[model samples]
Target: MGPGRYRFPVTPLAPGQAGPRPGGGPLAWIRAHPRACDTVLALAVFVAILVGAMAGPHGPHGPRFGERDLTVTTAVLAAVASGALAVRRRFPRSVLAVTGVCTVLELLLETEAPRAPVACSVVIALCTLAARTDRSTTWRVGALTVVVLTAAAMLFGARPWYAQENLGIFAWTGMAAAAGDAVRSRRAFVAAIRERAERAERTREEEARRRVAEERMRIARELHDVVAHHIALVNVQAGVASHVMDSRPDQAKQALAHVREASRSALDELRATVGLLRQSDDPRAPTEPTPGLAVLDHLIDGFVRAGLPVDLDVPRPADALPAAIDLTAYRIVQEALTNVHKHAGQGARATVRITRTADALTVTVLDDGTGPDGPDAPEPGGGHGLIGMRERVEALRGTVETGPRPTGGFRVHVRLPLHTTQATHQAGASGRSCRTGETG
Candidate 1:
């Protein structure tokens, strides 16, 4: 309301909400509310100035108040200026501009003796503006305000060129603006850091989910390979047992035994495969040795017992093979024989050939029976057996090819790296010669 002073709202004091004594006596209650603190401070300074004017000078440095109309006008203006400061935070820039203009006009109007309280209002407004705006804008606004007020005081006021009152106004207003701008910058920096931390946390969660999906895929592949090979073997032996039941009872009994063994093996492996879901505190699961090239003889014997005519060929002094290579070779042979059992009719013949080269082992399983084009050929179930075999060989850095042979049968060919530890040991101690190498 006054030329240089601020006006703040003064609601009736709520229960237990009154402030401390004025003039720095007890500032404890004002500390709880900063905006209220600013308003109270402005009011306190104005009241002190009013009281000082009325009491007159005690020392040589004290104020000299005017009488009559000048006194009345100054008092009214000071009251209005102090009152405006109550809403400064809600409209900092507007209040600062209005209060600054009024202070300059008042200095000019009261040329001989301007009021000190009018200058205090300009300081409170400048500080509020700095706290609400960015640093660059605060600097520009604060500088212009200080310069304008100092010039107005010097040009029109009754005060001397270096009056202490005028210098105090400049010092107090600049400090308030600087302090408020510092608080603004610190709060912004803290908020930016919190945002970055949240983003990093989200990225970490996404990476964890990707890893879980990849692990699930690996487990699914393993289960497919294990189930296909064992089930095929059981089906072949059961068919043989049924066909020979009356005419060859002893042979039929042996075939049934092989069927039971194969079924049991499948159940055990399936349980192990699915047990990955068990909780960590559960008892350690049973582990089974993976089938490798060394077990080819036993696998061939099972097919023979199931009534398929069989011929086997292998080179002597087999070279060592990598563990992955050995396992891949075994799986390829197992899958090929299983396909032959499923598709080949009664009295069909199969030949398993294993050749050793300096660098790799080559296996070929050929069956002379209804091939893919044959009308009575069995429909492939699940469709994953061949794919699983191919995947296994590829994992070991090997290759496999399967198709109908020119001789009216299906042939599966696989090449696996030898010189593996298992092959070397099996070849060294036994010194066994290769099996028969002629076509059946």
Candidate 2:
């Protein structure tokens, strides 16, 4: 596991486990019942029609279908239509076919007894088909069922072509189908919106995680560079101390002192690096100062001691630059000089220039040495020093340019804003005074 990568748990049934069953427990139980809800509704309709039959007159022209013994036949047709409702959800087309046939048979019987049971069954079948199938299928099935049943009633039944009972069947069936279709469409639309929202949320979370990981990696890289540079110097001094212990005891003592100083500095920087992991409110976490323009002289002296010819030419500023801008300028100069020491030939002369204006400050470093040329000049492949300088400057809403100068040398130019220069000046002055007192 690298420093920044995170692992999240995976659950197999997570989505399904997130909620109760789709229709609520009771509705789901009802739907799973052996008889089905539609069948129960159909049976209720049958009982109501039977009660109406028993209450009516039984003589000729008195709800008994004109003295014909039609009770058995009507009862059988109603029973079959009611049974067909049980399988509506599983086989909606089949249920519709069976109900359609039963409807025709009931019309032929021409019973004055109520036809509500048959109509109820037809409504259930149409609702099932409309809810389950696409609009095209629903239209085809609904239209065919309506046309056939209406034709049958007018051709063989006692009712007139436009009788209320006949028209009632058409209206109720159409309304049930339409209502069922609307419910299905609304459910589908809601589901689509929910899926899109979830996907967007997941994308945003992944992006946030990626950014956090990248930041951690950047911090790790900085820590590595700081530790490596300081430790290398300490190691060199310690070697000198060991080599001169007998022949040059005083020089060896001085080298040991330098080693101790280097070790202490490394420890402070390492503590600062580790302190980044602490919460913002933690008291013991270090609040290390960032190196800024105030440190330019020290930085130049280090390169000079390292056997590089450097000339620093910074104009006196009318006002102090912003802390961020000052830091950018210092780092740009530091990285440029470091590159000259690493890439330029021995004894190269480098010039650093800083110019401040009302709104912006520009820092430019030019080295007269046999550095990289042509396209290779801009590629700081092995080291991030130049890249770090560029990033620092740009983060202050500034610009940076680095390439081979036309005069057989390398150059880096940077411009930074001075919008917050006054505040930064006050803070830096107070901080510097405090640091000086502590050192004293």
The most accurate candidate by lDDT is: 1
Candidate 1 — which residues are off by over 4 angstroms?
A: 1-90, 119-124, 156-158, 239-255, 287-440
**lDDT per residue as tens, model 2, 177-285:** 7976876676566556566666666676786775565456546544644554455456556766798899999988877776776578668778887887799999999
The window of 10 residues in a row where model 1 has the poorest summed lDDT is 431-440
Assess every candidate by TM-score.
0.57, 0.65
Model 2 TM-score, all chains together: 0.65
The C-alpha lDDT values of all candidates are: 0.67, 0.66
Worst 10 residues of 2 by lDDT: 431-440
Residue 216 lDDT (model 2): 65
